[model samples]
Each structure stands twice: as C-alpha cells, then as structure tokens.
Target: MRLIIGGGTLAGKPQLLFIHGIGSARTSDVELREWSTSLANGARAAGHADLVSGLTQSWAAETRFANYSDLFYRADAQGAADGISEEELPLLLALLEEMTQELGHQAELAGDRRSGDIIDSARAQIRAAVEPDAVQGQGLFAVVRRAGNAVTTLLQLPGLRQASQWTSGVQLLPVLSQVGRYLARKEPDDAGQGLDVRIRERVLSGLDPSRPLIVISHSLGTVVAYEALHMYTGRVPLWITLGSPLAMGALVLQRLAPRPPQTPAGVERWLNFWDRDDIVVARPRLERWMEANALGVVPVTARADTHGLWTHTATKYLAHKDVAGPVAETLKNL
Candidate 1:
C-alpha cells in the first residue's frame, strides 16, 4: 500500500507516521483523515492554531498511516472471526481474563457495586468456558464463542453501554484476537515470514530516511512501531505511544522481539500517554521497565484522561491536550 495519504507532494517537509492498533479496517485515506482531524483538534486545544491549520490543510508534515490491519485477513475470509487460530486461543483467553479482573477491581474501587458484580460474572463465565475439561469436548471454537458471548453480555449491560459504544455490535473476542495473533508471532502467509515480521516491515516501509520523522502509535501498533524502530537506521525526532500494552508483563513485555527492552537507538525522545480507564493499558508507565538508549532517550510517560466510558481509541488519546501538546510543539520546531 502507498504510505503517503492522497498521494500528495511532500515538498521536502517533515514526515508524521501514524501506526494504528487493532480493529482498524478502513482504507488508508479514511484512517489518515480521521487521525489528522483528531490530532488537529488536539493541537488547537493546546493553543497551536498554526499547527492545527497546517495539519488540516496538509502542508506542515507529510502524514502517512501504516495500515496492516487488512493483512490479518485472507482473500476469502469474512472478518476477524475467520482469522482466529487455535494456537492463539490460550493468549486470547488469558488477556480476556486479565481485563475482566482489572475492570472488576476498578469498579470495586469506585464503589460501583452493580458494575463490579457484572464484571465478576463475566470473569467467571470466561473461566468456565476455557477450563481444560470444558474445552476438551467442545473444541477451541466453542471456547472462543462462549467467552465472546460472555463479553457481549457484559457490554450489553446498561452500565457498560456507553463504554461499549466504540465497538458497537463487534465482539470483544475478535477485536482482541488481533492482539493474540500478533503476540503469537505465527506465520500467516506461504512466504514463511512471521506475522510480527510482516507488520514491522509494513511500518518500516513508511519511514523516509531523508526527512525528519515523528512516529505516533497506539495500542498494538505501539508494539509494532517499537520493534520496527529498532530495525531502522534513521533518526526519529519524537516517538509517541498511546494506550500501549508494552508494560503488560507476561502477556506482552516478556514476549517482545528485543531482549531487555530499551529505547530505540535512533529515537531522540519518546513520550507515552495512557488513560486510567483504558482497559488495554495494563501499566501506564513504560519508563519503569525500559532502559535508555545511548542517546539517553527514554519514554516520558503521563496520564491523559478521557470522558465517558471507553478511552482506548486512538482518537480519544490523541485529542487529549497532554498527548497533543508535545506533538504540536515538535511539529512547530520541525
């Protein structure tokens, strides 16, 4: 796929690469426009009116989107449900359980008894569906279906309806299946390249060595961007990760490509933003586990809150002033 949105001329401007998380199936142009609009709104809120105009008008930076979500699907598959594999089932189940438990804890801390009860019920259902004796006769698909139905039931609750709005009718299982698949690092194509390798290649292909580059990645995309950055030789002025799962110890961190995860050598500065309400974010601070590169570059993390129910969307994170201010300032300098 073409990296440049709208195939516009760069005119020797700095490049801004956006790496999206899972469940993004739209075309590159649509994704680019939506992301640019959200980023522009955030810049405007941060009082960077000039930067806002540049972003909206497509003049300040050569914006590109690394679109790899489509790669998860096959030519004949209907959707993500068809992409799920038996090997990824265990990881998916583990994440679902972890998220349910965390949400239950949060609900309890807030003294929301009803929500807590609902989350607890969901957790129990997931566990029951995945138990060894239960799945032995039912098969992996049975576990997937039962666990997904549990999430659907939880989302359908009046208390969680708002939070589930982003997903609409989509099942949480399929949305999360993308994450499990990526972390599993299994080969999806006949070429023998692992899924993670293909995704990193897609991200790296978007980088232009001749221009000053800034990378903004969210959720699973953050994982892809991090690994790709290590393979890159060009300098990156700024790298931003939003709602990342990088700090998720067993489910993610330990399974990462590079050993003893550290800041990419080419990154001059890294900023990580997360929302407390975002279930996808296991830990908000990445600097705690990551080491500084030779250039002394390490992720400076901060909390950026979002209103209503769900806060994990890339646009929601980008719209926050805390996340956008640095981006605008960096663009202004670039």
Candidate 2:
C-alpha cells in the first residue's frame, strides 16, 4: 500500500481519492491504474480533453486509493469450498431479501410484470432454500449452498440475467460475504480491532485536510467513505458515490456508524449515481433518505444508465458520460 504521509496532493494540485468497493484484493498500484484509466476514458467521453490529459499525466501523482480489502483476505481463497461463514449468513440473507424487494419494485415501476413475477418466484425459492426443515437431512453447508444456488438461479433467469448481466452466483456470494463481514462489524483482524474500524481508518488516512479534496467511492466503499467523512475535520469540495447500497435500509442504512444518517459536514456537494438495472442499488435517490448537513450539503442523485448486463461494476459506472461529466466539471472548476 502507498502511504501518503503529507497528504495526497503534489505541489499545488488538488487531491483526488478513490475508495473502491468489495472484492478488491489486488494491489493498490494495479487498482490505481485501472481506476485512472476508467476515469480518463470517462472524461474523454464527456468531451473534456484537458481533464483526460491531466488524469493520464500528473493527476495520478495526486490521486490515492484507500485500499482496505487486504484486511478481509483469508487463508482460504474467496469462493473456496468452505462456503459462507455462519456469521456472514444472516447478513447475506438480509441483503438478498432486500435486493428481491427492490427488484420487484423496480419491475413495477417499469411496468414489467414478467420481471416482477420472476423476482417473486426467486424470493420464494430463496425462502424455501434457507428454511431449516428444507435441508434438515443436510448440514448448514447444504443450506448455504442451496441458498447460493437459488440466488444464482435468479440472476440467471432469462430476463433478469440479461438485465443484470451478472450470471455467476459464485462471484456474487463472495462480494456479499465481504459486505456482510463489514456491516456485521463482528469480525476483527489478528490485532483485535474491528474490521469496520480498520477499514474506516484506512479511508481516513487518505484524507488530507490541507488540500482541495474530491472523493469518488463505489459500492461498499461508499459506506466507509461516508463514515470517515463524518469523522474528518477537512472539507471536501465534491463527493461522488456509484452503485451504493446505502439505501438498503435493514442491511445497510440502519447499520451505519453514526446514529442518524446525514451528509457529512466536511462535504460541500454530493453526487450519487445509480443504474436502474444495477442489482446492488436498492434505491437510486439518496437525497430522499440522507439529511442535509450544517453546510446544507445534500446528495443530488441522478441515474446514469449502463445498459450492460453487469451495471454494478465501477468501470461501467465511470464510463457513463452522465457520471463522468460532473467529475470533469468539478475538477475544472477546482
């Protein structure tokens, strides 16, 4: 991991920090390259040649990634034979239940009755798959396996699969497991510090109160960034969250660190982006749920559609002009 002792800024340039979501076990340098490339591509798509040039050049020197996924790594590789741990099971179930409900609601909004039926059927299948008596003869592992298969089956459904672009239950399970481990706040590293605390510390370390900072976070990282900003004394000119689950009431919203959720005092403006087909997103509009902070900073939520099958990917969201345009504009003004 690259340490930013004096803050992320280089010379007088502003700092841009990227906080990634779940399943990012790769090195920070590798992720920085990938994320920077995506952001540059996005700026190009937004017709900001200057921003693209800057990102491709010295802007990288000023950028930092809050890499915390290393803390969640296990001796057994992800998606291994061990399956989801008992501690992570409840969180996964809660997330899946909430996802199904949101999917049904989205289908209704789109007037897609067939999709709604498919979601309802999948919900029933999941409920039955996890029932104690359903797998009485089998062990707990059997129950988890069946539940995972059911969720995968739902994703593979003809319509839903095409819409979501995510077909592997194997891939989804690990992502949910990591997210669960963080939100459950029960797991600790070898040092005895809570995983949540450690993860937030990683984020806080990248924050430099001395510079004009812009934070761009995705998925579960949004949760970490949100909490870290609350604890930070610096001010952020812009904050962006993509495909976040913060609106997943029971599983995420209620479990946030601060008592009642509000825009972090340090943030001046917040932009939240979501795709209707992104299964990770429960509700697209965060402004409706999170209260404005003392700075009167409330999230301005917008839809940035990525028609790809898997709209949840950070790169996919970054590539959208609607999403990238704002970042470029903010940077230009800064």
- Largest TM-score belongs to which candidate? 2
- In model 1, the clashing pairs are none
**Displacement of the residue 114 alpha carbon in candidate 2, Å:** 3.1
Record all residue pairs in model 2 with backbone atoms less than 3 Å apart, i.e. clashing: 164-309, 165-309
Model 2, position 302, has a per-residue lDDT of: 89
Where model 1 places Cα greater than 4 Å from the true spot, the runs are 1-12, 76-83, 108-111, 153-160, 163-170
Q: What is the TM-score of each candidate against the true structure?
A: 0.88, 0.89
lDDT per residue, candidate 2, 1-334, as tens digits? 1223344535446678889997647698888777878888888888986677577553533778789988887675454434576557767777888888888898899998877887888788678755756445665577677667767766754434864434567557767777778887866768888889998998878556877788899999899888888898876888999999998887899888796889998899899998887777787788888988998989999888877776777888888887778778877776
In model 1, state the lDDT of residue 71: 77
Residue 159 in model 2: shift from native, Å? 8.1
Q: How does model 2 fare in lDDT?
A: 0.78
Q: Please report, in order, the local distance difference test score of every candidate based on alpha carbons.
A: 0.79, 0.78
